[model samples]
Target: MAFGSVVERNVQRPLMRLISMGGAPILQQLHLEERLLRRTSDNWCIVNDGTAPPTIVMGVSGKVSELVEVEPVLRDNVPVVRRFSGGGTVIVDQGTVFVTFICNKTAVTGLQPFPRDIMSWTGQLYDYAFSHRKFGGNAQSITKDRWVHHTSFLWDYDVKNMNYLKNPKRAPEYRLARNHTDFLCRMNEYMPSRSVFTEGLIAALSEHFTIQQTGPETALSHDNDFEPSTKLLSPQDLQDIISSKESSTVQRVPGWPQS
Candidate 1:
């Protein structure tokens, strides 16, 4: 769509769906964001899971073989999900807070639908929520005139889970050759509570975007209208993919974390 047309449509559409995301398959979470970007015209900002079972998620452009130690990941019985966004691999488990903001290019003042611009805006926004430590990672996925830019703020994480990810051939510049534990910082170090921080964030974001609280029931309700070509990859699907790889790849897979 042309820029003018997109802006015009966005002008008429002002509601930003704030969906609560939790306890679902991490791959399913990724696919929902993909669907929202491609299939719907509504603005959405997802405040996702605070914690669930451990899972290792890789960016879409991230090569599974390069970023993951398949054996350790599988042996650990953790689901390895490849997201549709471009970002470094990370392990999601108890205490990881996921925040996503999807909007039209013109939705926010001085904001462009482009990647770098959105990322920059998000960094500032994150700073407002987490002013003490810099946000560890941010990602962008653009479609037509709308884009999804999200960040993961770890509250607390296990050092052992970081071992599932191998040193990537390509990594975020901030990583600076540091391993996972060294690279990311927990949000808990700064914020007293997840609810306190996220609630404050929602209020802060409302200043820039016309957001409205919506239950998860309204999630993908518009999806009956448009569906993407790519199917959501399940844990079993990823496990099979890893199992078929070379023996060397399988050796790195970690045993399932003891419950």
Candidate 2:
């Protein structure tokens, strides 16, 4: 389905709460997605300029041993976080930009709440927003009534950070076995500045929603009482995964081997 049709099908454009969490910590940004998806019924679109510190974020079903170079990350004390969403593992720093959409199943009239459809819908949106730019990666977490679609755009990157992630056992055919440096491109090379890119994204988004501006905290219903399941893993946690040698039940992203 086309991106425009996702919204045009509805007689009234759905209200989307927009928040920009500039340079928030990866874990907190992740927790917010869970809160917005589970506690609230309204649609949301969150943008993060970058993560506070360098961190490796994995999907719910991601295997740290397979996707990350665990020893160096553990030795350097780099935070390793597993999000509630399902996607490939990514190591992000101040150079990465994040855009996430959390919506009710009813938000889009006929769009199916499946990963591929949501991704296709977003792909078209980006194509309209910045036709020349490329995305870092995207993943989706869908439930009976809601779904969150998030993507990373590499504004700039530190080569050293790429050392933290290993080549996936299965990768997209387009990768062609290129090393991290060759596989990823910096958005700054294409756009003048982060601000300019963001402005364009907002403009594209305006085509779909009324674009209500909101504080990230306003979306939370029980800030103090709620505990997040997605967290930055500790030394013992990594050790346990290493020791067990068991596989994960969570499904891998497309292009990744199922087993």
Candidate 3:
């Protein structure tokens, strides 16, 4: 028995690394961690960028004019940021627990090279933590070899804050209405503690891959090239956003498309 255990230890290898972060501004949390995911040679990384203060992040292709109630959002001083990945808009606050699993397809044996497959894999793990409720909002980014799947687990979010967003025109088919609350499931309803939930995640992942619990050599907040999209939302951007809506409202005379 001892010899067999020794042999297993000798052959075992680390298939993933864990880097956990505390709290930070939402924009910095997403941008810096994403940059790390792109630059690192490590194939598999599990990151929890921590729950941020109140902020709304939109998908890369999202037009600020379409997804949010602009004046109310601004009146409330809520900053709107955009992420590089393609996903829907979400309001994040301290009650939101973030868990990210990113890996090259080659790192995990038999893992599919598609987003839905990857999402399914994550859903299975989160299922245990959120056993009674499926209130996780998931998003992903993929490349030929690598993919990132992250989710916002609404633990105990402020119900009132859902007012900041307007119903999107192209709402998900699963979400028949443009309503926000209808789409959310609170984490606290099932999993009482973030720590316990993460512990479950670590144990669940250990079943498939050897997960090494280690901090990154550098911190998540180390200055990076990522800048807040809201910081750059200038007067011209606002004018453009307003004009973008206005142009869509009025019928245009027949004209050739611009280059």
Candidate 4:
């Protein structure tokens, strides 16, 4: 079916809650919690900017053995987290931004299933954001399920820079950090700032979904009544998570992955 027809069927299905988070680790935790909640409630959507503290997160399908130099990351006090969703491993820092959509299967229509339609709708959202920019790349939808749509953006990224950070021996199985290719900007030469792209994306998605724009909020904080999962990793537990991948190969640490 055409993308628009599929989206229309799903748009009015229900009120899907969207939550934008601060960093990668917190995003991972929230995604897990939302998935658990979906087992009972099943009607909320969440979007998060999983950037900050500059860490590398591997998707469920991503092999930690293939993604990073784990030992160095641990030594540097960086946390390597695994997300519940299936996608390639991603290096998230202050620069990377993330968006997640969560909802129930009944909320989808026209499309054969929830996953398919979510991917289609998400593609349209990215198209709207990129259309306004001179340089833009495509949005890659990883997996489709009744619960969530997982995707990432390749902003002005440098292939050499990523290689230096992850030190992938061969070209990455997924797209490597191509200097010019960007999901939200054109050619990566003269791109808009990360804030500009994020604002544009939020505006487009709000209009497309016919939902009001809600500002950012903390997912699990002491100030908020909502309690974080006790299952959350403590500092030592996080270290164990990193150390558990003892078999993963290691590479020399570059001066700074960002610069």
Candidates, ranked, TM-score = 2, 1, 3, 4
Which order, best to worst by lDDT? 2, 1, 3, 4
lDDT of 2: 0.79
Model 2 lDDT-worst window of ten = 250-259
Model 2: per-residue lDDT, tens digit, 1-259? 1223234534567689999988999899889888888878889999999987899999999888899886677667788999998889888889999999999987865789998898777765664223323446888889899999988888888989999999998887877787787777787776788887777777777667778999976776545567777888876676556445644553233332233
lDDT per residue as tens, model 4, 1-259: 0122223433453455556565646455444444434343434444455466665566555555556655556456665565555555555554445566655445544444444455566666554233433222112222244565655555534343343245334443333444323322422334446566566665655443555434334333323444332232234543444546553343323443321
After superposition, which runs of candidate 2 have C-alpha atoms over 4 Å from their true positions? 1-11, 127-134, 222-224, 240-259
Model 1 lDDT per residue over 149-197, tens place: 8777777788788788888776556557776666666777766788876
* Model 1 bad stretches (over 4 Å): 1-13, 128-135, 225-259
TM-score of 4: 0.58
C-alpha lDDT of candidate 3 relative to the true structure: 0.65
lDDT of 1: 0.68
Model 3 CA lDDT for position 177: 76
Judge candidate 1 at residue 199 and give its lDDT. Answer: 79
RMSD of 2: 7.5
The candidate with the higher TM-score, 2 or 4, is 2
**lDDT at 167, model 4:** 36
